[model samples]
Target: MAIDLRDPDESYVSFWRERHMCTLTTIRPDGTPHVVAVGVTFDPEGGPKGIARVITNKHSRKVANVLAAGPEGARVAVCQVDAGRWATLEGRAVIRTEPEAVADAVARYADRYGRTPTPNPDRVVIEITLTRAMGRA
Candidate 1:
């Protein structure tokens, strides 16, 4: 019931643009999935080969989940849904603690979510290399 975004129609793009929030899902060590509602930004050129980034802190459960799964683990997916459209981005995440990566994530966060991120080593950026994305118009 999902259509891949490689060929998204106008309605699908419109739906995506209209929504400001989406749920991000990650895998726990027990092989269960965890979902969290988050403010998201659309990367006109992100995901898979484009390097999708999500801003989060080390204290967040999602961060813990991804770190436990390891960088190459295939146990992550990010989903965004509105009334008439939905998209699921499948991928693996790399935990980022480096300052440069954090800076990039902070810039993205402030630009999209309008929140400033104070420098903290405990904060992390989950960079997801999307394998595929499915959306329905």
Candidate 2:
């Protein structure tokens, strides 16, 4: 069963706040899954509201994949695991290239990871509006 993460429990929120690496999966044009390790942040108040954010280069494959999926956004999944504990987030992803969006993503990323990422002129933010969440947090 899918867990409602719109208002995740404190424990789950805490789990995400840790510096665990997450695997992001986006769909390739040929319908294959393109998975990559990414630094992500759980923003309960950002994006379209209650979305996970990933900041990456504009020319990256993941960003291209998301944009290729069209205006409604691409379907994506993000998962983090630590031994016996794991959590998965599945949602629709929208690529944001606007300055305000990028700034918000950068701030949230720094807040979670504790270091400001070096500014990239070609940076883009992938905003995932979760539809389902699962696993043992």
Candidate 3:
């Protein structure tokens, strides 16, 4: 369903803010989905709409999938579930390698997951400019 990031449902926002393992789904070059467990952070105040970030190594397959999509970016979704509640953030994802971007992603991840991510020279961030949300949350 459609979602207004500027002022989303409190339940939805609350669920996303909680610490829960999430899954990131990216389309591979063969048009098949490549899903993997990941830690995701959501910032409703990030941009014009909002943004969800996933910090990962540049060599990760998920990163490769996004890169294969090229300039237009890859359509992606970040989802989490617990008990009977769930929520998903869907958007076009881009791989950001700038030091500043990676640092920011780590900070956000720490805030959500309660621990700083391990330092990695090859770190990169997958940024999703959220466009839709759905689930029972």
Best by lDDT: 3
Question: What do the candidate models score in CA lDDT, each in turn?
Answer: 0.70, 0.88, 0.92
**Model 3 TM-score relative to the real fold:** 0.95
RMSD of 2: 1.6
- List where candidate 3 sits over 4 angstroms from the true fold: none
**Model 2, which residues run further than 4 Å from truth?**
46-49
Query: What is candidate 2's lDDT per residue for 17-119, written digit by digit as tens?
Result: 9989899999999999999999888866554437899999989999989999999999999999999888888899999889999999999888888999998
Rank by lDDT (best first): 3, 2, 1
Alpha carbon lDDT of residue 102, candidate 2? 97
For model 3, residues 44-76, the per-residue Cα lDDT tens digits are 888877999999999999999999999889999
**Which candidate comes out best when scored by TM-score?**
3
Q: Report the error of model 3 at residue 27, Å.
A: 0.6
